[model samples]
Target: EGRRRGSRAEGGAAFETARCPLPPAVPDLLGRDAELARLRAEAAADAPGGVVVSIVGHPGVGKTTLAVSAAHELASRYPDGSLAVDLRGTDDRPLSPRAALEQLLGALGLPARQIPASEPEQSQLFRSLLAGRRVLVLLDNAADEAQVRPLIAAAPGCLTLITCRRALAGLETARWVWLDPLEAPAAADLLSVIVGPDRVLAEPEAATELVALCGNLPLAVRIAGNRLATRPNWSIAYLAGQLRDERTRLSSLSAGDLQVRSAFEMSYGLLSPSARRVFRRLAAIPGSGFGPELAGVAAGMSAAEVQVRLDELVDVNLVQAAVIPGRYQLHDLLRIFAGERLEAEEEAAERSARSEELLSYLLRTATIAGRAFDPPVLTAHPFASLDEAAEWLYREASNWRAAQRRAAAAGRHREVVDLAIAMHWYSDGRTQQQPWDEIFALGAESARALGSRREEAALLNFLGWARYFCLGDNEGGRAAHEAALALAVEIGDRTEQAWANASLGSVLTRMGRPEEALEHARRAVDLSGDLPFWLGQGSIRNVLGTILRVLGRPGEALEVHRGLLADIEKHYDEAHPFARRFFHSATLQCIGLAQNETGDWPRAAETFRRARELFGEGGNALEEADAALNEGRARREAGQYEAAAECLRAALRGFTGVAAWWPRARALAELSTVHWLTGDAAAARRYRDEALALCEELGTPQARALACELA
Candidate 1:
């Protein structure tokens, strides 16, 4: 890092290059002979006077020791005494310029009365005193640029060295140096200092192994070395005993005057109690990053208070202030510490209850916001907290999933049994709502946990329908529906009973069991009237239309769709919250198909157009594509050749799956007629073959006839 950034100073005492001293005593920095030589050379060169050098890296990386060593080596060149200030940049009470300069001036034997009161006057006085006298100013544990800037003595004879846990890039005058982990040989050398050089030299392999376990962090290694240095009776192999235990691995980093936690605790203890409380709770948050809004939620504090606490944590190096914007995270080491404290500091039962409440709050919020996203239903247990609930779900989607997973793993069977019930809207909202797979797995797990035939049956039935219709997973669709049917029979829940019947009917229809599917649809309709109208009435009626159309009873299907359409129009406006949902759009598509099958081509075209418009509103690519295919089919049958050509081109662009391909092929065959009628035989022939291939591929006899006619 020194070579990367430091400019080489010309001849003269490099220490005259104006360096700062670190604290009075610092040991355990060894094996940087080549590194120290480079720094010493830069310090000697007089290319630029008043140069500020900063030492920066992760904690326990030996930045202070290197800076302090350089400061002591440079002491002889400066007749005036060197000054060391613990700026505490990452800690609370970043040493203010007034306090630091007062200490520096007083240390040099200047009377307290002689020092100026304000920051500017004191800065000038300090510079005046050090003007001709060569001095080294080592600002140790410096916080940030704002803390260190005022303390810079403006004399060419004074060299300034600042050490911090972070790169003080904000200080324009500072040359940056990074204190990375000591290398293996260097760490071994550091270990030698604790256990004598000869002992480490004898067991180089063990020494190498020890450093690897240390993560090459100076703080952790020093603790290991200290254990060996003080306890001569403890063998190197015996020290390795404690190291083998994962639980107590970081324990080695604990001892008198040198502990990672103690260092952390000292900084933590300095915080206001409120900040400490917020600090620990922040660990309970699930994501790797969080916004201030989430921090506000986790702390149950005001936005202003959360920001203040965040700043406090950043100042003390407990939390890193997110550099991008509106985010924060604990460092890995600090995260471990904070997590441990969260569990230990709070009663286990109390923490567990709070976690449950937080998870319930998230589930309730997600369901509400999801409903509001399109208000498709008034589920029996609709969420009460609307606005606040929506806001929370929008913020903590990931946390809710993590919580759901954690609950399931802990054998909290009840939680597992019903987590997906809380998140029902996830699958219902369609594939665009990402987190669908997670919601499905959670709901399935919850059903497994409950082992209640009724709940399991309902979940299986509903989840199966969603997978088949939305995700288009045929195997999952079949298995889930089968499970629902068997469980519904076992539970005897009439609503789920009818739902299971309808679910099997649809999957069976997709599997080409039209006759059997027609029987199930009939059974679903028979059971529908005894249940709630909204629960299965609309669905069963649609199923009836589907079966009738398959039986070539277009007249009956058209009549069913017409009546359902009237009910929808009479009870709800176009902007009715639920009417705007994708479910309503799907119903509209069935209505359009019924009309087209019954020979009301104009009405079919209009209904398809309306459905397409509705899907477009939500940017639902899949729905819009299906609607385009239907509108094209209606246009083709209406003998609107030019219009049909336009519609089919759009359908091809928008359609996705098998259903779409069949309609699109029919439209293509019709469009070839348009070409043949317009005296473009070559274009007609090309389109005819394309349509034939699609028909053969999809096994559409009706479309194949049109292709053959065009040929």
Candidate 2:
């Protein structure tokens, strides 16, 4: 340790002796072992002049702590001395490069009179002093590249470590290390360090919850830990329960001077007015992640303008760029802070207007995207292609779904009904029925409230399909379809009547009542006769063919399905490719079923394969899985056990990926059969056990049948 000593220059001005003034390394530096090791390695690496390492991250992310810790660890490598200084970059009054040079000169043993007044002269003198000597300089809380540029020591054997909240992209020669919030394990370990290990061990679940509530941020965890430590009477669970309130979370994460909010405020204060406005307005959006387009719509800015503003926010770590390109998200705590700022800075009316605008935009865009799957109802929209429309619908689902809820709450029933109606055909391709259940239920209620029986019947038909196919609730589906048919007949809405009859026929067929299903299916085809194939007639015919096959009329079912395919080909247009593919795949699967019933296993396998490919092209994961299941069944009937097992496994994967528990259970049963036939007794038993468990949970007729078979 080089101790400071009083010295006088030739001109009689006194200065303190050059000394290693680095602060003591943090005793419990958790969650930064890899970062510290990398810093040490870089410091020890060979360089012509010196190495400059810049540690960058958001405020309260422990950038300065890491820099200081690394400096202390590598202190012995530099024989001359180590120096540390705080630039106070986030303050209203940041230290200038010239003033920073004055401090560094004093620290380097220069007398006050000998230190040059000009920045360039001082920089040159500082470099000259450290020319041949190995010294470590730690510049903490830097404002920008400009403030840090002059302070860099260019002498050989001198190492400089700089830390800042923002990335100093303008700094050319420095190696950069980015810091993110601590991972859960490391963050919990840090919390355990501050609060006693025994206390954390006693309430492990609360400790995990506490860290997650802190967003695994190091400073928040430290403050929370310190608060728990000071109040010996407070349990970890008690403290966690207190932090659960978002309104008071920031205020709660405080111990003495360590406050998460104050650290965030410093970063927030540095943003431009426009950037700040965008930042706060973003909190009004309903989802965690969004793109520039949504941000632009919310902020009332153009795409270009919002992109520039978003870049500005990302520079300061206020917003993070998502792994998916063109997407960004604010940190959980930052989002809360932004929401607080929005309420504080914006008027009530202005905030309401902004939120309403975003909601309206989301709902309108969603309606347009959903319409891409329904070709006959063409409307002017932003999307250029079906793929783009599908992407937007799935990617922005949370936002649009939130908008639907808001619209319902605000009594905007027409808008809610319109969005739900558009999602009718679109929901068929989605992975789960839960979202569709909520959407169609709200739509049906809104339609009922508005006295629009036709819309209500249509929405109820959709709800029925979701219940029967997606949810595997035959009774619920039959009830919905019956209600929808009653409403449709009362309103003389033939289209809705056709949909209701078709849905009811499918549900009845699944309930092992094909004789009753045949009557409803034929009536659906008749009711849909005036409509085009892509509209409703093709689906009705497919239902009719399926009922015929189930009732032991495979020859008639084959003719019906072939005729339906011919009708589709005759009326197909390239403009409505998704609708065409969807209908074509549906017809092919019916044809495959008829073929399977007629003992044409090879033809059925080929037809199912084609249907699976078509469904895949239409982005219908559930339908594709259905085709695979059918193909596996056909292959098994043909005595192709190995091929059938592969097909069943593929079907299982598709079902599991979409969380379609009923279909997954069905696939598991099919796999068990194939495994049993192939002499894999253990695998067969395992598959049967899983299928029975799923069936026991589902409590559906099909599940009960499968369970009986497994038993």
Candidate 3:
């Protein structure tokens, strides 16, 4: 009786209580009675959040048949209806979790546009939609735990059945059912059901021999039966004799054109010349799966052409279609088959050319995507819009990341350097989300190989930045920046020199060496020379202002930030809003911190509010939390204890969301100060103790100061 709102297109979001209309169950499945009984018992005993029952077997086994039969028999128990999906687990291109979610949601009446872009967000939304609903979700041929995890219902009354070739041992909650090839009786029974029990009974010995020849697999047995059904005159002995050869067993398991190889060859033969070329070339890709767009690059066709051919291949099951549109995968045997064809038909030069083309396409597309976040590159670019670029980056992340490593191994040093350099700004926000040291390390090595000193210096600087800010390796950062400085000095690249000094200053500040940091910051500012407001000068100034504040000259820091902000306002290019907002937020945060230091509490609060807004607008959650913490500090200094507590709590929430422990600890300390000001000694002590412990664990300066104060 439950109802859900449809998307806007479906009658203005009216509720429609509906259930998944599962496909008809396969008929006459043999040797699965025990497995079926086990599945039903488990489903009945499943917890409120549901249970995952994974049916694992080799490819061409009867796993899918058993799952469908079980779901049909147990349909009445789940009134909310049953859903099923093919995950293409045995194929190189298995379905993506996000795409699987989209299908589930679509079946539940949500439209494509309504689905969230990110997998995490989509998963949350899907879970919320399924809350309290009793549903049977059958995920067939799932690739791994990751693909199935997001689709498993959390509702109490739901049951999820998964089928895959591998055991998926990583899914700890799953109940395992390993399907071995059918026993002799079951295999003979399955063939009899497909052909006819009378025919099978008439030649029991031949039937048994034929089933044995088919490897006792349901798919092979069914195909063998199908072949015999069409040729009623052929004796079971004749068929068994035809399949006796092990090498040609698969080839002989055909009825006319329905032969195993014929089934594949027919689909392969039907492909347009270009699609066949791409399909075989794809076997050369190292990754297990690839997106449709990449298939175009591999085939030397346009995106539109690749999609059409991929669909044709999927139609005949030559290629397994992923739940996510635009993704296609081949089964292990199919990939091997494709490789055989590729080796036999294609020239070495042709294979190498296709591989290089794919690499080039991935490199170019990655550069375009990364440019969306980098100020200097995005200022006047026209290849892709920001949204398209960002979408491409996420949707094709695996493709390009693999390509980067492959190209590096192939000694495409210049291309690798170009790709890594383009990611400079984009990498800043993803320090924790990605392992960037590998990319930058390879880039630096490639730059050195190419004898490009400027590229090497930039790569080293980026490497150092990631180490300091993301990994907390201050010593590693210091070494890399020193190398960058040495190289910049030798090459006489003033821009790189400024960047090296500014980057070093930032690292030094974090290491608590304010005086040495100040020396670098001042030189960075002097060398920058106003190339463009946010490009180099603004960056150097922001570090300079921070160093001045730590040196206990808040008045001077405030003066520096004030002048920088005015200059930025005059020269700020609105062309790349994302980059502009990031640079401006840093300025506002510095100015607000300086004001807080000078006891301009009210002004500081206002400045922090602006900085928080800027950070939020730019999607910088960590920086936004820091801004909120500063605002709280300003309010606490102004004696507005209640408001200070509220602001600090907001900062705490933001920090927790991003798991920024250091900032979270600072917010706790600020809340402790607010409690003390409000005369709550017990509350103040509790908060202070927690903050002190966290700071000690983190080895922050706050720990030392708090220890001295307590003593």
In terms of TM-score, the best-performing candidate is 3
The regions of model 2 sitting more than 4 angstroms off are: 1-259, 315-317, 377-380, 569-578, 598-711
RMSD of 2: 23.9
Question: Clashes in model 3: which pairs?
Answer: 48-156, 92-288, 93-329, 254-259
TM-score for predicted model 3 compared with the true structure? 0.70
Worst 10 residues of 2 by lDDT: 1-10
User: Mind giving the per-residue lDDT tens digits that candidate 2 earns over 277-372?
Assistant: 999999888864799999998898988899999998887667888645799876555777888899999999999999988999988889888887
Taking the tens digit of each residue's C-alpha lDDT, what string does model 3 give over 1-711?
000000011101111223234546787888988888899889889585787799988766778888899888987888876887666565556767876775676566654343443466456656655666787888887888888888998778888899887888998678998897889899899999988999999999999988876667787787677667867897888777767654543455423212344334534655678778777877766554677667877877777888888886765556776545566767665776678778878998987788788888888888877876675565445545766776676566667777888888889999889989887776654443344666788899999999999999989988877666555578998899889989999989887778778877877887888899889888888888945655667767878888899899999999998998898788765436766676777788889888878889999998999989988887676677788999999988888788889889999887665445567777888888789888999999998887876666556466667655643
Clashes of each: 15, 0, 4
RMSD vs true structure, all candidates: 22.7, 23.9, 9.3
User: Considering lDDT, which of the candidate structures 2 and 3 is the better prediction for this target?
Assistant: 2
After best superposition, candidate 3 residue 596: deviation in angstroms?
Answer: 2.9
